[model samples]
Target: MDRAALPGGVLTGLWQRARLVERRIETPTAVTLVLAPAEWPGHLAGQHADIRLTADDGYTAVRSYSMSAPVRDGLVEFTIQRVHDGEVSMYLCDDLPIGADVELRGPIGGWFVWRETETRPVLLVAGGSGIVPLQAMIRQRRAANSDVPFRVLYSVRTPEDVIYGDELADSADGVETTILYTRTAPAGSGRPPGRITQADLKTHGWTPGFDASCFICGPTGFVETAAKALVAMGHDSHRIKTERFG
Candidate 1:
């Protein structure tokens, strides 16, 4: 069920004024917003926030977006991928002005989040903008100065579609990052463009025997395919967590 359709009392209590303090262009179609909320209860790495936009005509649209970075002071940040014909996303990525305010409620989703105290190895598989939350986990790991082993497998249509490309390149210090271009591989690339498969997971992902915690996020189809591949690679289903969006 859409949270917006629920009884107002259920969500109203969590909504607070969030002012857009900073904006960044992530890709041609994506934008990142840094907001300062009137109040915030710190959030876990993979959690998300719900933003509500109401027009003068009383029409309202609400959408959930994953946090892109760990909280710094009283600020929180999330990236918006402009969805064609998306009421909320289009406004957020193209029209929302700096210093403008929106009703924000979050620190949502506890099951898929990653905590700094976790010591086990982590396997992060992302498809397209699904990297948002996984990126948060990576940032949090660095912020906490954790040495936990992390391996990231990111699948995108092309190099141009990769989000946080520069930062991901710099994440090689302790994190092993691999980009698998599904449609257009860059020149001189060793692997041809293709969908993620069991071989890909076995070669790049943590071994099933390592007892790694796996987080997979993407569109429904992509998430399902990746999760299935992991299970086929002998990973315990219980150790896998997934968060998917359209």
Candidate 2:
């Protein structure tokens, strides 16, 4: 039997150990880790994994982080932001050693995931670090070489806080990315800094008639407001999927 199989030969799919193979500092508060699990079954974009860590005294801590990019060669990527009061996140972003093993399980979460087979026009809205999962969907769309039109509306406090900003800016080939700076905009950008308003949605988003698949992720308030804006614009509620973070 293979290692993925249960010890009783039950073929049970369960949590397996994963080692952090690489880590990239995305920003002052955020970092992305590339991990290889011993029994990975592969994962869809936007799915998340729960990581488990144990202290020397047997105190275990677990936290879940969504996949930041499409699965590749069994390597799962998770982008984590450090919450000053969050123990797990603090460890992940500040002190976790490279090559250390952590217990991980998942590919969990079905509702928010984006499979490569989706062929319709794709719309993604992200606020703050919520871009992580949506970015995964974007990567999946590209990796599939599908001609599905992609659009992203990324809202950030300042130009410096945009996660994956360079890649988002370079999306001129087939994807369009719009930056909404709530606190400040880069010099030379004429648009005033503001929150995502109804007008902004109507201007940059798909109409209800287009039947585009929309994915919105952000803080609870941002997600709620964006989702409502889509609904008010006659978008079918069923076509919009939302994932909210703190």
The C-alpha TM-scores of every prediction are 0.94, 0.92
By lDDT, the best candidate is 1
Q: Model 2 clash pairs? A: none
Total backbone clashes of model 2?
Answer: 0
Q: Positional deviation of 68 in candidate 2, in angstroms?
A: 0.7
Per-residue CA lDDT of model 1 for 54-80, tens digit only, reads 999999888878889999999999987
Q: Cα deviation of 139 in candidate 1 (Å)?
A: 0.3
Model 2 Cα lDDT, one tens digit per residue, 1-246: 001111221122577899999999888888989998997877778777678889999999877788888878888899888887888888888888999999888766777878877877888999888899899988888888878888899899998787887788877567889989999998987789999987888888788788999999888899999999999999999999988876
Q: Against the correct fold, how does model 2 do in TM-score?
A: 0.92
